[model samples]
Target: MNTNQKTIICFCEDITKEEILKAIEQGYTTANEIKRHLRAGMGECQGRGCMPQIMKLISQKTGKPREEILPPTDRAPIKPVPLGVMGKISKGNQKGV
Candidate 1:
């Protein structure tokens, strides 16, 4: 635990604790707003990697409770499927479904 090292909140996005706090200082008080500003929870893991910590930071900075923190809605597909695999799902091409 090197005290001088920046704490990484979002491993997928490489978002640092200081960066999130800076967003807070700039007046982005809510977790989702901060996520939007910093692109923190928009990475590959879709916020599972960072939203909780972001919520914690937001709660600490703004006196908001964790229960009240709501992460942004995930727009990406929950699981990725190969294009060819998806093509197999058609009525005539049900071979690989």
Candidate 2:
């Protein structure tokens, strides 16, 4: 855990600043690349929270415009879903399919 890294940024995966920076240094500049390299954005929340900050860091370090960077993958269940909610949703929709 690097002291300079925000402990909460990658809370779901516990990825550290050192790891993310190492990925950036290794040419994984995009958010998706970083996610793939470190599994930073591959957790339950699907990175809806940490992605913006990650992108900002990557842009600042690589001197790339934030807009030029491709957005992170929008995996299903953008928000955290409780198990009960998931079960209810599944049951509710099963009749249609």
Candidate 3:
């Protein structure tokens, strides 16, 4: 186990810096590859919480600009639905969707 586990990079996914580094060391250099390997930016925060730092790490490791290191596949953030809300929403949107 890596002692640096507490050094969390993706708090939403509980991903550690060591895990990201290991993924990078194992040739998962690109943002998508790193996402697939270690799930850094696939958390509830939708990469907002951790992608900056992850990109920074990648930039530092490979001498790439942080702006050049793209994040994982972008998606809408997850949100909690109240009870029965999803059913109502889907039912209302069925014709439109």
Candidate 1 backbone collisions, by pair: none
TM-score of every model versus the real structure? 0.76, 0.72, 0.73
List pairs with backbone clashes in candidate 3: none
Write candidate 1's Cα lDDT for 18-73 as tens digits.
99989998999887788788889777788887888888888888887878877677
In the range 2-77, model 3's lDDT, one tens digit per residue, is 6633798899788988888888888888888887778777766677788888888888888888888987777632
What is the lDDT of every predicted structure here?
A: 0.82, 0.82, 0.79
Winner of 2 and 3 under TM-score: 3
- Candidate 3 — worst ten consecutive residues by lDDT sum? 74-83
* lDDT of candidate 2 over 7-58, digit per residue (tens): 5567789887777877899999999989988889788768877888899889
Name the regions of candidate 2 deviating beyond 4 angstroms: 1-8, 80-97
